[model samples]
Target: MVQKETFGEVIRKLREESGLPLRKVAAHLDIDPSTLGKIERNERTANKEMIEKFAEIFSTNSKTLLVSYLSDKVAYEIMDEDCTKDILKVAEEKIKYYKKVKKLIVMPTKTKIKPYKEIDSDVLTLAEEEAYQLRIGENPDDIDLDVIDKINVWDKSVKVEENGYYWKGEPYITKGKLPANDKPLVVELFCGCGGTSLGFELAGFEIAIGCDIHQPSINTFKTNHPNVSTVLGDVRKVNPKSFLQLLDGRQVDVLIGGVPCQGFSLNNRKRHENE
Candidate 1:
């Protein structure tokens, strides 16, 4: 069996075949002579630029050099490892999955969300409609349309979080309007005196519930949102069961809140209500 040559070996062979001295090639490649020698011995790795330069110096195919380099890397990486065949088998599947998948950009947490436009398209499927529910936060339309098409077709593969909407493991695909509602339901956290909830209610959304840490603020919230449920507790400790019971089978059409300023935290040396 003929041994497959490593990238360095192939390049070194080409250099020797051309009768080019090592230092002369190193001068052309802009690397030290020792580095070039190590590369020839395959004790150093070759970068893409160096591979292309090697091809230029030796009049060889750039692709052939690159292929040898990549193959050597893969072989060395998997060599002397347990279950090498299993590693390649799983890697092959992952490579296929990656090739078939588009890289999606995830929006940062705390990204400001724009309310979706009014729903209008007749071609919208139920799956697409449910995907629209995420618009209460981010719309998937903000991402690649081709990627969104795949996501919608693939059962919407998403996880809704307090931080943001995730597609598979990626975050914040925005598009499509919020679900149709005459008065979209609203729930508030860190609801100091229900100011934001009051604004949504005035804008035609129904204030469903509000939670605040201060008894005074909760009382004020009740005064402002007479028909809405009120929870007086740190939002972090609010009972999930009671919270859901307050929803009473109705989905939250909106979640609005304004928490204490960072200045209010004990960590802030000058923290005070004035902040």
Candidate 2:
């Protein structure tokens, strides 16, 4: 069986193999060196898109890179011992199912574990557990109920307390006109739910192509942007040449994206230190 590695270990391994200094890699990717440094240290999780970028820069596969991390190993082992193996196994299966079905799949819960009569009665899932754990909160780690329900509970509780929502229901819009003869064009990366793409449309840009790793989000995007082409895979795995090919003879005016945000959270405080 392939052993799992941590985020830090993989970053260090890739850096060493690339024969490039940290600054050089960061400069090439337009990332701050200190941010890259902390990712190597496993203090934070890189978002899906960024992990793909790292894989591309280092000439490695994301799955191969992810499984080599020690932290992932530790986390898996802990989950297994805590009887959450079934949840992870199921989640992996669901992801596979989505790929095979070529449709959007949503896993809102893990194994169905009912709450005690003396406690709350709700169900949850493994993905939900991880989401709850990753959030900023003051809850003790408890896996009695389903992880998904716990996350919902957390979300609802937070919403009630803050009287806030994560995103505005309304979208931004702009108006413009392109030449009738101008070729329709779009370049999208980390294209989650096509929010950025919508923004481009508001500005009168026609989307020709888009890419993202999340099958569900991509499926939703495809439904909303039926005329646009989409690639259901990591952007890093996409060959730059292939990306160029999608545009054919047309020139792209705007590149839209929501590249990994988690990586920046690690060293955002130190961003101005060297300045």
Candidate 3:
């Protein structure tokens, strides 16, 4: 059987096929030839920008190239772990679900009306009171009235399912009305299980999107907030523009992230302050 080629191997093969020397390509990318060589040998990792530069040089799809590079990095990082295969399986499932949800949200349909008596009156009343307060001083056009409309939709009790996930309980609506002129929008990076997103939502912020590499964590997040868009992939592999695309022209009020901190955690087996 032929061995699988790594991202490094693919890059090296392309460079050799194009008859470009390491020094020449490195000069064009403004990186040292030694650094480029290490990257090709898998001794060093390339950032997203560097990978994009490589894609340009090789005339390849930047997203595909970045995914390959990130896959290699993830593999290397978890090589010594016993649950690597399980983790990857979960990641794949989560990514698949994320794509499905993204498609559904991008093209939503009108939800059918149901009897108001069957709905949760407490939540509906709260939503109505909040909406009234917000509209008291602001023009209707200035506010995202769609948010209130969403609350009204939730006034009907119905089971909803999307992309294999099901919900029949109270709708996961924001606790209060967002500001008429400035609804705070957040983009969360490394958003594990969406704890921060939940907090922000409770504080009346719109969670524009969230991203995480781990599959199980993202699955939990999706289960809780099915309406929020999420990306299941390595943050290093994702382009900044991709996050903007999720916003769909909405301005981001906050950008939050909780990067890997296992090495610094007190419970870590190999804890190090300098890490």
Candidate 4:
């Protein structure tokens, strides 16, 4: 059997077979040599633009290279666990069912639109399985019930206390100090509802503060993480001096942000509107 090569391995093999130096290829791709090396070694993930450049430089089919790149991403993410195969199998079935439903809705057929309560049990099972997979992926050992509970809370009105944070009615409270963390402080900008901040906190980083323009999002974030200060207002209009004041002379080890994706996202209401 021919051994299947990973995306990075294929890239490296193609480059070497073409007698192109790493530095030369990196320069052509307009990326740092170290970054290219990391990509070839599978230590780094390649973005769509980088993959496109690689495909162009190597004179390979872009779609084929893209598939390889995406496959590598899924492989690395799941780490090829036995459970992942089952999850993917169910996911594929769900996709097929969804497509069939969509076709029925769009094809002017006599098929009745199924209400939520009337949906197939198999669909519900698929959804539940997918959710379980996501939860397991995040908390492998099925630990951290607090985080899990908070994640399942769809209503903002419901109050739950866990891990040092308490949500009562509106504002939350920190029952104790931030777990005596010595890790570097992180400041998250455009932090909608604190999902990313929660991940960082779980990874042992102390989140000093977060900022966002949406009031409801800020409220949810504050309610979840009362220990971390939250600022509400347009990020562009917020003064840099204010951030320094929030830092209180402490060094900001890392700053993270997810810039608004509405303009670029296909699901956005104004996606087709010109900037």
Q: Output the number of the TM-score-best candidate.
A: 4
Badly placed stretches (over 4 Å) of model 1 are 1-3, 103-275
Report backbone clashes per prediction.
Answer: 9, 13, 0, 0
User: lDDT tens string, model 1, 1-275?
Assistant: 44499878887899999999999999999999899999999999978778778888999988888888888988999898989899989999888754433222122345544445566456455645555554345564575656644543112234322312111231111111233455778888888788898788788887778776666676787788776777665565555766677776667767777967744554433333343
List the global CA lDDT of all models: 0.69, 0.60, 0.69, 0.70
- Model 3, runs deviating above 4 Å: 1-3, 97-275
| Best-matching candidate per lDDT | 4
Per-prediction TM-score to the true structure, in the order listed? 0.38, 0.32, 0.35, 0.40
List where candidate 2 sits over 4 angstroms from the true fold: 66-81, 93-275
lDDT, candidate 4, 204-255, per-residue tens:
8889888876667878988888878777766666667777766666788989
When sorted by lDDT, best at the front, the candidate numbers are: 4, 3, 1, 2
What RMSD does each model have against the real structure?
23.8, 21.8, 24.3, 14.0
Q: Answer with 2 or 3, whichever has the higher lDDT.
A: 3
Clashing residue pairs in candidate 4, if any?
none
For model 1, what is the alpha-carbon lDDT of residue 166?
12
Q: Candidate 4: misplaced stretches above 4 Å?
A: 47-56, 59-67, 70-215, 223-226, 231-275
**Residue by residue across 31-66, what tens digits does model 2's lDDT show?**
888877887887665555566677778888877765
